[model samples]
Target: MNRFNWTYIDHKNERHHVGLMHGAQSGNLLVYCNTDILIIDFQVLHSHTYSFFIEEEFCELSIEKTADEQYLYSFDLNTEADTPLNRYRKKLSKKHLWQSLAFLAGFLILVFSLTISFTYWNKYNNQHQFAYGNGIQGRETIAQISIDPESEGKLVSYYFVANGKSYRANTKFKENATPFFKHGMPLIAGDEFVVKYAIDDPTINEIDYNRPSRKQISTYRNRAIERHLAFHPELDLDYCSCVADIAFKMKGINGLADLYFQRVSEEENPKHNINSYKRLVRSPKFTQRVEEKCWAQ
Candidate 1:
């Protein structure tokens, strides 16, 4: 059983005491005005409103569900019956509702603004750290490249392994950017490149095109070719080696590195079922080179 009480004053300056007794499980309710019992019900299974008169003045008692799914009891007293106290109560209720909505809107705006500010701040902080912090040399594998729909700039996505974990990131280059867009030089997916990343946070990194020398490119190309031939034991080593050398000559170090990294990525994810070597063999340049260098007498 739960008990609730309230006090009210009427138009004639008369004092009144309003009290209620509720039996939650039994659905029994008792309402009292001063010492007089005004209403009684034994079947109050849900929230309800009760209206009664005291000294010719109107009064209302309501039970309703609150925000936390709990029941609340409210009492109101009116000086005249013609005043329609419920209408006034409804107006006050609407005022509170609007106030609550305004408060919520302001809170959401503040949170959104803070989120945007923090994101920019974090990016700026990371750039600063990468620029001045002690960074270690790391190898990055170019995963994909596409033109940004909004900026129409070339976006290069890449990944690197650090501390035995892989981290992925992307950079954007305008169409006129040097080296990347130099005549006869085309950046493609699966290219391996040099990168330096903050030792403490691998996410802060950038590509360094001048980092790889010709010798390093040869080493990468040879290692990749060796792995590919091992994986496909039936492939002719002379033909494969000729094709790889032709590809390096055609695309330069970046091109050959791309082929090597693409093979590495494919090996790492066998389910992808991609054969970059076959694709290379099918290209006209490689086919022509294979005939001229490996088979032509």
Candidate 2:
């Protein structure tokens, strides 16, 4: 059986709240539950003899999962009664990297299956080009900032014009792929020119490096960025703060933490499988603030 102690330490070391989570690495972590209440368990896949202990009652825990993996589980303890957090957590899904894309991939699956599913789900009947998506067009390489140098780019906001629109997807360097890569020593600012965004949905998002020793496409990619000059270049560089420009040019969700189903009432859920009560009581993100935010009295 997996074993560990969740301990609270008031060590005379520092001040900030520190959460030390030690668990065995294995098949995947599970929100193990009984019939009574929801309970979380950190499944140890990698090592042997795992141990962690906690004082407070924690109903939630996080786990890692790769693509194409589904979790299967069953209740072990005498499930039933008013188990509260323990029972609820069982209904929650393990935190899947498939869900977070945790590790960065330069040439990622750019678009996931869900991204397409949702897009069409809304256009089932009236598939006509109805200026759909709150910022769906934001997918096609809206901006590409060369981190070494500084620049600014523009992407028009159509918020009032449409809802459910997704903005530019912030991607990363892929681990398996040679991947298009760049870095900004100076912080990238909202006003910085990244990419001019020439084409519409479904465009060539490329770059050039000019390294004959490495890849021939480097030169082409470099030239492409060179030619991607912004039409009305903003008066800003990578590190400058345009704070407002950011929300306008980014995707909506990041990971499971954002998965807390707060207002999925109008989320266009085609599955209809969305459980209202499960999301309400089981979600780790749903931990009440009034009880959570207060200091130990």
Candidate 3:
């Protein structure tokens, strides 16, 4: 207050309070004069710097003299000599940088997550799931074995011939096992049984293990698919079916449409299953020649 008695106020006047560094004091406060206020310096303390509001007829007030450059360093409380606002500016700068970096990282992770989800989701939704061939086709043979009179023909230990190989599958049914047997028995020795297996893991062959029930066949086939895929990690059901068809043809099936399922264990032969299919591509007719000179003795 220049006139300590009265401080000036005008109609076109406004003030900005910058800091109140008075530690717990009620009346002590610091204010920043707006630059819009055309304040005039009371004396040639240096050049025009800042002026306080005086309420008198505008009497001049005296201040210490200093060089012009020194005046830039220090000023009356009305000038920009406050410290807290500068600290606030610095904090705002740091906050802005942190927010920007966080946004960038979150955006990149979102993009990657969407890309991965889309890829797997597409695979799951659009997977090839068609079962090839309407049914089994092949030659028929009557593999006969003596059965208990009460058990009927289902007791016959059957031998099925497929892919130029005769498979002796146990179809012997007992009177005690009859109720379940007649329903689940393979057509006997040398009888062409219709079987389906994953061409991926040919060892997972299914040949009417529980006959007259298609449900069992599907259940076992699904299990086989899971087990084969666990080890193979390649060759899905569609691929396996195609390969099985090729192997069936290579071994010279009697009927292309109705060959029986022969649950044969996959041996290390690697000559008649999916491996053989792959081998055939690498070296043509290898499977054909082996089959032509076949001996499943």
Kindly report which residue stretches of model 1 are placed more than 4 angstroms away from their true locations once superposed. 1-85, 132-155, 173-184, 213-216, 219-297
Q: Which runs of model 3 end up more than 4 angstroms from their true locations?
A: 1-82, 128-297
Tens digits of per-residue lDDT, candidate 3, 48-127, equal 32334422112222233344323222332332334454455567888999999999999999999999999867534332
lDDT scores of the candidates, listed in order? 0.65, 0.28, 0.38
Question: Candidate 3, residue 79: CA error in Å?
Answer: 13
lDDT of 1 by residue, 1-297 (tens): 779988787646888889999877787899998889999999676889999887766888898856664678899865435655656666788999999999999999999999999988986677665666534433343322333446556565666677787777766654435233211224444545566666666777776555453444666577657755766678777765765677778666544544454544454533211365456657897778778886852
Backbone-clash count (model 2): 51
Give lDDT tens digits, candidate 2, residues 1-297: 233333223223322221323333354343312222233335544322222222222322333333444322221222233454445544443344444554444225445556676666745422233234333333221232222222223222111111233334333422222221231011122222222222343221222211122122232223222322221144233211121112112211111111222223434332211254244335454334313432211
Best candidate (score: TM-score): 1
Model 1 lDDT, residue 283, Cα: 80
